[model samples]
Target: MAAPTSEPGTFAVTYRWGLPLDEAAIAAVSELTCHLLKGCSPGSSCGCKVNRNLTRLVRQGVEMEMPDPTLIYSEGRTGLPMADMWLAMVNPYRLTSPSRVYSPDFRRPRVQQWP
Candidate 1:
């Protein structure tokens, strides 16, 4: 959990994986998480504040994952239920889709040096 920012009552959740996950996979997961929290169907074309604010936030920093503001109060929608549901069955390893068997960018082994 991150410290509250200049935005009133706003905070961020940060994650650092030991293995650097693929950027595309991370993005898919992030968007799915956002939509789930906003009570919006995945891939829905809703012009809701949740989507708009999230897009802006992600654009600002792709390295950081941004929570859907609408789930809190940005869109006047309380997402407590959705949040609870998520927490009850959260799986960090869950993927939106199967990853490639091998990719130079995501699957390359890291070089290590012995002390």
Candidate 2:
């Protein structure tokens, strides 16, 4: 099992494969993560924080083979039970999709490196 390493102010959610991904969802998360990571201003819409380590910006949802997961928080309005249901099942390769994928910028609190 992946141990929880959520920072005190960080929001987190799991992303599993074979799930439907919405463009709006992706945009919303990308903005949130980038803003929270201090990459961009609250007034500006910066894309998801780029994981300079991986040399790519983390998106709303990732592929199954993605080894590291980003931060994901549930939207207050949309009560998608998808995460709960997904957590119950047995899927080892599941990808954790937090509402916002943490910025991969080295200075941020949650940066990931591929093993």
Candidate 3:
């Protein structure tokens, strides 16, 4: 697998295998990303944080196998249920907008003098 290249605030995670990723693998990647983000310091960019940890996981013995959903269920196995559900919930709300913009309005302050 190729190493991930990320900018200061942006990260790109790529799966190098020619095959599509399975749900379990996707879930694992998601978990890994979250773990990294949680450890990031305040004011650190999230993308960079996630990418760093993902690189570690990929380096580890985690297989990039893409398992079939049907096969997983056929054996009456609940395979990575929590991650799957969390992904389902988070996917829809993933990128509605860019980062929040805060505006500042500066005006002369009104002072009341004692009568």
Candidate 4:
């Protein structure tokens, strides 16, 4: 874990496992992003704020790798700070948003305990 956000369960982690980085692997990575975005306390003030473009790309039925070398993106509460760091490192010249995204304007997903 690089650094944890204000949320107790959220952290900025860099997973650099050595592999061929195939299309299947990229799909799995994208799915992991989805999981992290969906993993949040329901009805809590700290919820996930997902990127609609990413979701749309996922829904498009096309399999392609993300261009950025950062590999992972954290838009929700779990990885907001990390996301900022990512943007700064990747594109420091570009104007980026701040930490005003703590509360997602949408409802969060409810995860149930397994039997």
lDDT of 2 by residue, 10-99 (tens): 557778887675765455555545455664555444444444234345567753332232323332211123433333343434546534
Candidate 1: residue 80 Cα off by (Å): 22
Worst ten-residue run, lDDT, model 1?
Answer: 49-58
The residue-by-residue lDDT of candidate 3 on 49-103, one tens digit each, is: 3322121224366655545555654644334556556555556454545667555
State which candidate has the highest TM-score.
3
Would you give me the overall lDDT of model 2?
0.45
In the predicted model 4, the residue pairs found to clash are none
Best by lDDT: 3
- Give me the displacement of residue 54 in model 2, in angstroms: 40
| Residue range 14-69, candidate 4, lDDT tens digits | 78777676554455556556656565645534334433344223546876543332
Query: Candidate 1, residues 62-109: lDDT per residue as tens digits?
Result: 556545665555433334454434433443454556566766687666
Against the unseen true structure, what C-alpha lDDT does each candidate score?
0.53, 0.45, 0.56, 0.50
Give the lDDT of residue 54 in candidate 1. Answer: 41
**RMSD in Å for model 2:** 24.3
Query: After superposition, which runs of candidate 3 have C-alpha atoms over 4 Å from their true positions?
Result: 1-17, 43-115
